[model samples]
Target: MRWWWQPRKQHGRIGRQVTALVVTTAVLLAGTWVGASRIPTRWFGPAHPASAQAALPVDRVVWAWAGAVTTTSATVVAEAVRPARRARLVLTADQAGVARSTAAVPVGGDGIVRLRATGLRPDTAYRYVVEVDAIADHARGDGRFRTMPSGPASFTVAVGSCARTGSSGAVFDAIRAVEPLLYVSAGDLHYGNPARDDVTVFGDLYRQTLTSPAQAALYRSVPVAYVWDDHDYGPNDADAAAPTRPAARAAYSAYVPHYPQPEPGGAVYQAFTIGRVRFVLTDNRSERTGTSLLGARQLAWLQRELVTAARGHAVVVWVNPDPWIAAPAGGADDWGGYPQERRVLADTIAAARIDNLVMISGDAHMVALDDGSHSGYSGAGYPGFPVLQAGALDRPGSVKGGPYSHGTFPGGGQFGTITITDSATSRVGVELTGRTWRSTILVSYRTTFPAPSTPPKPGTG
Candidate 1:
């Protein structure tokens, strides 16, 4: 099962089948010309064992990505290969600081071990190693993650999604080259869409993805903020009703080093901050119902978070893993499918005067940016915000979400980046660029945002 690509008529050309093996050898092969991007082979090809991590030994640790990063604290999640007696995380600041280790949290029945390192400096770079007594293959145990800045700062965030399940394409390498402060996996991190029966399926799939030398290296290099779309949560176009919902949520909580999930054992929605910007990540799949994209309670929380974030931060970034702008015949799988909800959100933003908002959405399989032109779906064009659509990491490309201000480029091996610079001036700098597997810029847009007129709210949020 690959990403949520439908029939040719439903998503023309998106059904172009390319098995993982076929992709690994050709289109995804390192140092090979990616047929989609039509670019030269510049990326460091597949890392060690790019095609075969499925047989990973049980003794080997599988920690996908370092996440839930904050100024003074961070979370590191590790999955033991099997029965383990001990698990811990050793952390050391990159700038020559005393080494520290977190006390081992009990490994869950699913072999999940979570560790949180605290008292770290803001925006500081640090190296960490996952120590698991049950795992013998811990050669790649060491990785790095940077803490978010506490105040105004300049940083870049790379966003990508819609890959060929566990593709180790050059796109991941390209994203790493930029050395982003964080990587926002917008969704479709994998297309397994495994049956709803077992939670271990997700664990193994994550192991495959995290062990893939390429993707693993990228995650180790950068902290990640991820939200799942249909393909990852369940089958194509899966919703809250999916039987796999429980298993998916369980796997996510146990395996992912994500921000503190607001609903804990429920929906996987979360919010985080970087410098003066606040990022709101919505669980587009878990809480989604037939009538609402983000169920009622989640929707209400999102509205409050948005208004609060907008008031406190200089900028608010909505990390929605579904297409916000509607496409022609963009039926149910996207925000286009829930017009009323869109109106509610738009109205909420307008009523609260949340003008410093910019949205980064995914599951489009294409790179498109709307410069606050056609993204407004509210009554009388009340609330408008710039939107950047990115992804199809290594899957068959298909355009959804519509006529972009900078036009759309559809194909695999794609990603997007957002760089925010806070200067002494009153306006903050926000730049969005869509790049390809070869790091080729397809479209770039820059917009200056006003610094918050009000004082920083800090914990008032």
Candidate 2:
């Protein structure tokens, strides 16, 4: 009987076909069983390897360009050993764990981690840590940063924008050579899109830009704050109506978690006081819709903040991703898009008699210094507040030239730095720093008062 069961040669062609069919069915069954059982185990097993640690020494430290005090945020591109594993971010005031706190989410593309530590004491030293996995492998490390002084203090703040991968890091080295107290990235941190599909690319680009040894060392030591222009947000000169808005928002949500920012949907805009100066940070990208320069609610909030600052001896600094005082209109990406609204803001400031107001912006990719003369406000129609437009750190050259030009320095690779000294004299001095491959330079400084000595009070003026 066993010999008969193994005897396949005795059968004809039909018998051979039947045998082949049986063999094929058996092979299929075996494959199905193995695949079903093995796949689940591999996916659910606890024995899998852990993810790798994120690359150390994150880059792009942007201090609050548009906020109250000198509050700031920093961003880093890190990776996990396993694709499914998540990275851990932490901020601390001291190494003793007494002042440790997690930072708020930042605003940018995905795969980027941000750690923001706020309510920091001015001019004080604080230690921080950026950990990968606290609960699992417990991977950890530390870094250090110092806050701006609460009173008259002399400290350098390195400011720039428009940096891309593959470029010489000499500019960053130049900025770090100054050993600035804080680092500010005005906007356009990266050129890659902030959409979902481009997140990995964005991360890669950011990683490449930060890989420089000089940039890493400075970031490890200094606190960074940032805002986003169109490129970093997605698309060149992108607006609120871009098709990738949702994807951009998701990326922004993911990237912002590594930084300290206010709650989402609740105005990323905020204000903080550092020394005698008040910094006002704005979210010109998120929650900004319509054809107007600023939505009604944000405008109202800005007016309120400005009014409050006018009553005190603090220097109120306003930062936006786009330049408001720069020339020839037609570009919906800036304040020029909404002339009515800009007029409203200018008139309000004039009516409130608010002094000590300074406006700084990026996104023009050129170093421009304007005093609001080209902003379309007549000398008699608006307050003569000094508005400064610092060119971009990446492309420090002008694109379109016109009659409203201030000083266009293209390919100059420049940024602006301001130094404030609060003394009994009640006058604030601001210095603008510009840099190039040749040397780091201090371009200019202007001194002004919160309230003019001979000016009438608000209600009586």
Candidate 3:
């Protein structure tokens, strides 16, 4: 008599549907437990005041000639209730405010401050000051940086990623030692999950590195540009489906503001040209749609940018969070996950016949040089472009997924420096170094790109 006991023509179908629903619910619950349990206990805990005299860890410096912007971001740890508010960031060029400013307010529990100084002269050295606002209960420090020359610029820009904030000191020291004109933090700036100290290990590790003598000396002398990857964004192999994506986005927002970026979510992936080289920065995260990695809009934007760059005699550098050729099968974390988008990008570049298309990325914990030929992907069709995967400045020894385990660095941390010399004959050189070891062990091809035949007027585009 009851519905449960009633038999009908569709009774079997209804029973199967109900069974499927129950199974799905159970599976979802199990997944939730797995995800929740994975979250480290340290992340949700309280904060502690760091040392007032603590040092600041500097990472990458970026120089943009076309926009007339030389930007730098540093990771600083100070002993205070509020490190961000207490810290002061200032940049001075020839005793002028070429680019000098203070750290933002309400420094988080991590004590990491992203500092940026903008509006500077081309090919010029500028002094910077970081101070603590005693009245504001803040700690501070000082540093210096140099901007790239306008035309036919001869400058060095260091590139690296996968730094854990633990051994970042060596990388900073290396950069300072080189005294590069600017630095480009390709991606994976932080280990991600700033709240989870153990899993990400950014807060403590960054604190240690910031206090390092070698690292402090460098922050006092260089500028930096930054981007985020899965580790730095929130969780390993994270994406739009991440349940805590909002929190991750918030953290990213906080982290990015410390640097001199155009605008948050306003294409963190942007294009900047220095000398004859044009950099096409891509934001694989943020604005990502569905399971696709780069999303439709970003892919379209990238295609347009690539086309524009190809039209001129400029070296086109494509910066992504993950290596394109490393994970050809789509790891849901790299370009492989978005096969359609990646194909579209590769196809577009190939179609354009962009000769100087160089791929720069981070995420793999070791230094690697791939000819852009991952399994499953047709490298033959893509014209055999070169993809250089810079090792992490930190977390060098950690294992990475995919068939490329052999390339992983055995050491704990590492970084790569890219130097470009633009002249009648433009040349680009890459130097892979160990942060803790302090040695330039690995080197890449020194290739020449087409030199710019005409110079464009400089101004904010």
Tens digit per residue, CA lDDT, model 1, 407-455:
7766667889999999746899999998877677877899888887764
The digit string of per-residue lDDT tens for model 2 on 1-461 reads: 00001101212211111121012365565653432211111112111111122344322231111111242433343333322223444545553456545643433333344444555554556665444444222222345666556455445666676755323334555666677776666677766655544545555555554444444455556656666777776677665665555655554555432233454533355555555565666667655566655566777888887887666635777777676763436656677666667777777787777767877677765455545455545334764555555554444244332223244444333566666655635465665544553354524546556532332222100
- Candidate closest to the true structure, highest TM-score: 1
- Model 3 ranges off by over 4 Å: 1-68, 71-119, 130-140, 192-216, 247-267, 288-290, 330-332, 371-382, 396-410, 425-436, 456-461
Cα displacement (angstroms), candidate 2, residue 299, comes to 2.3
lDDT of 2 at 393: 49
Using Cα atoms with residue i matched to residue i, what is each candidate's TM-score against the true structure? 0.86, 0.67, 0.67
Q: What is the lDDT of residue 98 in candidate 2?
A: 61
Q: Global lDDT of each model?
A: 0.76, 0.50, 0.50
Task: Report each candidate's C-alpha RMSD, comma-separated, in the order given.
Answer: 6.5, 20.2, 14.8
304 Cα displacement, candidate 1 (Å): 0.8
Error of 3 at 84 (Å): 10
Which ranges in model 1 have alpha carbons more than 4 Å from their true place? 1-60, 134-138, 327-331, 454-461
